[model samples]
Target: MYILIRYAALSGKRTATLFPDTPVAVACSLLFKFVLNVFYGTIVVENEHYIPKNGEPVIVCSNHVNSLTDALLLVTSVSSKKRNFLRLTAKDSQFGRKTFSSWLIENAGTLPIQRRKEHGDQADNSTTMDKLLTALSEGDAICLFPEGMSRFHPTMAPLKTGVARIVSDVLTRNRDNPEFAVTLLTCSLTYVHRWSFRSDVLVSFNPPLKLTVKDTPSLISTPDKPVDFEAIKSLTTFMHAQLSSNTIDSPSWDLVRVAKTAARIYVPLGTRMRLGDWVRVVARFVEGLAKPVEGTGAGTGGEGVAIERQGMKRTAYQDQLNALGLKDDRIRQSITLSRIKILWRLFLRICQTCLFLAIAAPGLFLWVPVFATTTYKSEQLKRSGPVWDTHDEVAQTKLVYGLASGIFVWLTAIILTTPIFGLGLFFTIWFVPAWMWLTLRWTEDLIAAFRAAVALYRLLWVSKADLKRLRETREDLHGRVMNVATEVLGLPKDPEAEFLVVEGEEGDDQPSRWAKHQRGRTRGGWDSALRYFSIRRRRKRDWNETLRWFDATEFPKE
Candidate 1:
């Protein structure tokens, strides 16, 4: 069921609230579920127990990545617990827009915060803070993105101080009452192929940081205390550190790629890691790569030179693998398989892919137009300007635009076919989504199986000399990665041991942890390198924009 249930305080009364148990709300909730589930193939929630089940108030602090969808996902994922409906804080500009989305957002109990940069002289969040304070006082869960704005980056931007100030305000008010307490929950969101439709999502909730007067001595001086600057700053720092622990906080996209490659190769043979576990291992690699090795001259440009050398090594290794028509996992796996077994696996994979292709053809026929339209729209927006070109805006357009297109397409189909199949058109509502969901699943399976088959086919054609040289290089790189992990980051020596360190429940089923790597290029060597550089240039620009909220001194000036 698609339910959009929320309760927030507005002028001392509950406004535009939808109770979870109401019939209309249930239907809406189901529709909501369908939309989210269709857009994302898998939604995994980790440390769900961190959400209070006893109906205590909570301030849900999350890292922003996917624009408006972040709050919606948090509500869907965490609202199941025994708490009052989760309220949200949205940008003031959204509430001011004369659009259906803005109307829907306001009615859904989202308070609007005025941002100084965006709102200029009109920026004033005092009213928003007052509403949030009132809601929390009435025992409601409040969700806000401390990053202030949404953007896609390997690491989180420096958080805004507003959330900490709110927390401090709440703590100060309840300082004298031992019975009163509020929970500060940190949620880390990770996506696989973030901008791609039907990709996987990981919503990880770290254990809640409880705020009780007994534990918070700094806020105990007075009941009517003004917002303490030092306390807010400290709390923001603490929250960032806590949230960082749960995220893959790589210094750059290049490091993220290298870390992922290392994790894929270092995984033990004959074992598959779940997405959550895979993320954990990748985070470990990122941490290692971003840190300086012992005896490296700290802050003397030596550390940067070392990191640059490692990045170059990673890029060269990837280029070599691309040239050989192989990936890190494939090269690691091909060694364990016999020639006959390889051929047999390839044959089976091809057969399976063909079966899926047949099953998915109908859905593909129906949905391809919608997909194409959304893709075209996304490209148009990207070329429009830097504002739309950021990863966040591109993804937001795909989802928002795709949702609108799907509805239009469905309604248009019903209108066109009603003459021939009057009542049958009604059934299309359920049938289309159900069949489209099935088709999408099979389509993914078909693509994966076909890629596996091709990789196996290419395996038999690789010369022994090239394969041997690639293996040696792979081993050398893997060793260097392990040294970083062990000596610098102080992770366990065994990569396998770190796999299951993530404490959380698994999703529907564990898919293979291997990510799609850049396909090998047999020709156009110079062209490939040039293309890579061009993409990097674009990404560097995107990264700089993503960190716009941070001070110039916080991160390297790019």
Candidate 2:
């Protein structure tokens, strides 16, 4: 009887008893993992230990940003050994389409919830609730997107009450089992460039929130009784707060980019900034700037002041780059050297690129079709999807389509190579993917080196006096912004302390040593200059450190 129900689910028909196919789930997970690795350059998982080792009953709640990638990242990151049974709750429309997607979702153990009305009447959600409760009761790890839908917004959308309601039902049903423990774990996905291929992603898992029948007495509803509306609302609010704290929120990507650039300049030379810390600082700064000021005759004074200060700093930074005939990319490339040194660096880079091209040439021929198809599909999806208002949405659309198209490309490559290579089919099948991965990483480094070389060439046109003046103005602007940020964030008003720079332990002679040390680090021309400013022997509290205080206060944990 159970097998029949499982077969029905796989056939795209609603079934009362849905059983997960472990082998299908594992295969789907591997496919998603392959696509993610090909799409993203780096996938950094923070506090992964927070994911409960002893499965018990768990529901993973995460903010929905990237369309399907959010669910893919969460599901694929967890080891199958750790949690053998994993299921997801998706909208009913996704399952009722009678398309390939429906088949995929059904086989992956996804439970569909009706999100719309039937002919102007409310559709019954009792079945969906019952299915969710049954899954939890069986100790399956359920992944849910409480936001209900994906958006390109910098901050998370208001969470729906479904997650809270589901939890409430599970707790009520398990009232008799005192030993049963259900854990709610919050995960955050931060994309450095959400829609772009070969971009970086930060996945953070916050400590789980343990709940029992005793923990939410007010939220519990009997099997036949309706859930308490107020209790569900309260729980939703709590979940939103917890989810928001772990994730980075910004009003716009422009502001985030500005803040990140400013932070690099604002921090003392010889110190490195963690990406998470940079995100927190930007969030805090933006939040602080948005807050209303006290004792202002006009309501816009605080906002106006922040805007003016931020504009002035941004302008100053841009002007300095312009004077040197450079842009943000070149500045970040950290190419500060004499003409003779730059020429030497350019020669070395050319040699390195030649070496890489020679090695990558064979794989390029095999993977070009895959790359071209994915890129074309991604562009078409971006232009056609509902993303005209924001570039972020366009990126998300491209990523969704790109990943879907990639699976076809991979399969095609395998099919084409298998018949041609015959006995060597296994090696041929894996070659293109491995080649594509290397190409993605190599191309990025190569471009950076090329940009640094161009910046170096352009530096020859600038006079020393002009460069010095620009540097002075840049520092002055940075100081002003720091002062304003400090005042707005309620930090100690020590202007001198903000500009304090700690020299390296070996003093002025350290540059040569650092240069020597960095020579062995990477082949990129920017390494020496970036390392010179970013390498520190010890961590110390500075203006950048003060930003954390605001982050903690502004986005307090629930």
Candidate 3:
């Protein structure tokens, strides 16, 4: 079964004449599911309703963070009922590849985009533009990374003029067709651990910006007009604002880390935050910490403390976190548990991990070669060039090489055992991928559990004194952050208060209306009931309000 599945995936035979209209859509969906479920863990999508399902052509624009992974996630996760034909724009160089990757690209229906850096001054995108225009005219969906390239940048790179130009050209040509409306949809992809296997990914789709001929009267005055450069520039700025609002656009990677750590620490106990909510909190931190403006005079003895200065202080706090080799969650756990209890928990966790390891031993043994091959190949790719050096690129290279190596391992195993086992090899081959999956699952859990346990053990034993000091430091830092948030971001006095509205999750507790409702109306047993109660007691804040500070239009003057 595994071999057949692999064969089907690797086959070069074409199916549908149009890209996504055939089995390719199903293949893409399955591929996405495999990646998100097997390669990664806990995929969350927010504002999925924003994905237009009315069959109107839409251009999906996203920040390029995870190389090809970004494109895959955007195309797969954001779907329209009327149109699942999502074509992606890739660099022209990638389209010419004759390898397995090129086959995958062909099946995916990707349009080749020209980049000046690669093609130099002679780069031509006329053919690609024609195809894109035709697709959009037929109400197809197109995904493009406005950044042109993918990297682990602290914030989005300056968006290319291509997105704006595409929008302009599409709207200008279709101005007379009142039925033709091209919408620009912004998708924000946030990976909790970019390069790590089984890391979490949050895909947040912002509300679509509908561009009708009527909406852009200035740019689409005449349908016969050539590409409007001024319209493209204006629209690009607008695109920047839309993307910035939907993404965590920190000024630097260090500041991004600082913001994330601050958010992790700031989230109140018993409150669960998905990556979407967490990013909004982080965005608030970035807005507060990125700029060096006068702090509210109330915090620092008549003189105001600039948020940028506060950010500097927090940098040291983040450094402390790194030095202690503990996450804010671990610190919080330590603060609540006695040292003896911590030791007990650590011992149990270790024993639990050992049990998992024992169960997963056979799978791990079989897959070790595949993993090693992928690692070696990915490392080589990292040393290849600057383009392949980013964490996401390495991950993507691993995905490619890992798939290739796994097939090689399987074929070799079958060849070796077929003579002795004969027909039995077919039955046993299924166990290969199955066990490998089990091992991968075990490994993911093992790493997370063991890391926390080790960190806890170290806090209780190795760096015993640092625990208390770190706790105090974290508390002090948390308090200072709250003050700055309240003063600088104009947050409420109790910003972390229950009933605070946030991104993804919103709405305050309905104390007045709860008495009018009955639990019998709900389904899904105790779990659903508990979830209902949890949400009822939960406080949410409109994270959009705080995140607006990072909007490109509102960027503070230096």
Candidate 4:
């Protein structure tokens, strides 16, 4: 029944603004993602808005990360205007028929393949290659992570030759037209606080690189042969320049990691409004130019009032899309109020879920000690990059702090109830659920924080004075949360540790999970990012200000 609603909402006509395969996929993904990005531990930030507007068939390649969460980020990065023709290549380990992950894959229109029993030698590379070629030939931009498996590595390990072959095959298939070049859009996603609430992800979008007929075929690696070292080397080098080129001159290891180690993160967009407002106005103009004319013809005996009602709806919708920054009438017909109705339901469902959890948090607080040993993973994820890469001490400290917070909560409860009686019954009924609910409640808060942050930044120029006050309020709120954290942990807050660098040091450098080919390499530029993005200039100023407040970078003296 639910599936029927989703399919009902999906547009099937060839003339629909969205591609036939895309609408349901887009709605489901975005609906699921709105929850995941908020409640689950994922953050989507600094999206590149330009590449999607340039709209053409292309391949998005990146290093593999755990879970299908990457797909959600990719979906949100795209503008709704150009989502019809995108698809993904997913492997079978997680995408088999009965699995939850597989359901998502199928629903998202992913093409799945079975991988080798052994890690490497016997893998059938041919079927995978064929699937991608077919998808691309159909004008669908294919998205795949070149590194097939997800494992912890400091650098991008040898890429399966499959991706290179796909590019080679596509260019070979379309050798005649210069415009038919296979475009490779490299995206670099770096986490400022990986997996944490309100974490920041910087997505660096490089200009698309075209591997044309003139480029040598020798760069394609062969499966049966020793993986072509030169070809793999060149590919990584090119990507390193595209993805990590900004790393070249940075002084601190942190900046360098942010710039290079994440060189191969992938981005796939369903619809991208990354176009500048002026460009959007221009694209809207172009779309208006291309939008189809819709003239309603009456059925021979239908009621005139019924037809009049439909006409009013059409008129109202035309006005709404124009207000949402869409200029084309084609877009108006595509996003019916029925589509927005689903979005409203998704929004309401998420709100109800958090509300229910907020009512249950107190009960969960009482069971913390039990969940602590069982939850064994509260701090283990810190080992991965962008934060506690080498911070075992920090990880251990987090566990201890968590335990301490439990103790503080108990003690506070005891103090509050001394005159009345034992607090356990009250707590078992109250704060346990409160704690449980807060985690989910915090999810909404964090997501709202991010959304509010983006919306506020979007209007910074027009609302400069209000924006200044808001940032001050944000800092004050952060300070209150920190205080609450300290009190819950029963720790006497130290004024000194406020400024200490507890996360990383020079001696603890571990290999970045994305760098390929050991020899040090680098590239440079922001002229393109600047010219295309007004936000880039504003972001640069904010980045510089952020650096000053977090002044750990020991810039070299001139």
Best by lDDT: 1
Q: Each candidate: what lDDT?
A: 0.63, 0.57, 0.61, 0.40
lDDT of 4 at 520: 14
Ten contiguous residues minimizing lDDT sum, candidate 4: 261-270
> What digit string (tens of lDDT, one per residue) describes model 2 on residues 1-558?
000011112323222235635677546666666667666644556565566643377888888887667777776666544555456766666665665445656666665666654223566668767877887787766788888777666667889898887888788888887666688888877776676555556676766888887766776776576667998898788888877765567666555545555554544331232334334455555565445456445674665566555564366565457455564433433336666876788778677667656765766665566557656766665566455233344443444455555556667777777767755468756776666656654554455445545666676666777656666666666666576566665433442343232333222211122111100011123423464222211132221211011101111111
RMSD, every candidate, angstroms: 10.6, 10.1, 8.5, 24.5
**Sort order, TM-score high to low:** 3, 1, 2, 4
Q: Report the C-alpha displacement of residue 188, candidate 1, in angstroms.
A: 1.3
Model 2: runs farther than 4 Å from truth? 1-18, 96-103, 117-122, 178-180, 222-228, 268-273, 295-336, 388-422, 462-469, 484-558
Error of 3 at 401 (Å): 1.4
How does candidate 2 score on lDDT?
A: 0.57
TM-score of each: 0.79, 0.74, 0.79, 0.43
> What is the RMSD of candidate 2?
10.1
Deviation in Å, model 4, residue 347 alpha carbon: 36
Model 4: per-residue Cα lDDT over 397-432, one tens digit each: 332344345546656665666656565566554664
Candidate scoring better on TM-score of 1 and 2: 1
Candidate 3 lDDT, 1-558, residue by residue in tens: 000011122223322223434477457456654654555544556666667763468888888777877766665565434344466677767766777656666665566767788779999979878877887887767777787777756677898887887887787788887656788988777765565555556687776888888767656646365555787788788778777765688777667766666665666532343345556667777877876664346756424446434644545765666565655666766767887788898898888778766776777767787678867877786667664245557667666666667778777777777787758589558766666766765655555556656777667764657777878877877777776666676544543453233433322222212111111111123424464232111121212111011101111111
Residue 206, candidate 2: Cα error in Å is: 1.8
> What lDDT is obtained when candidate 1 is compared to the true structure?
0.63
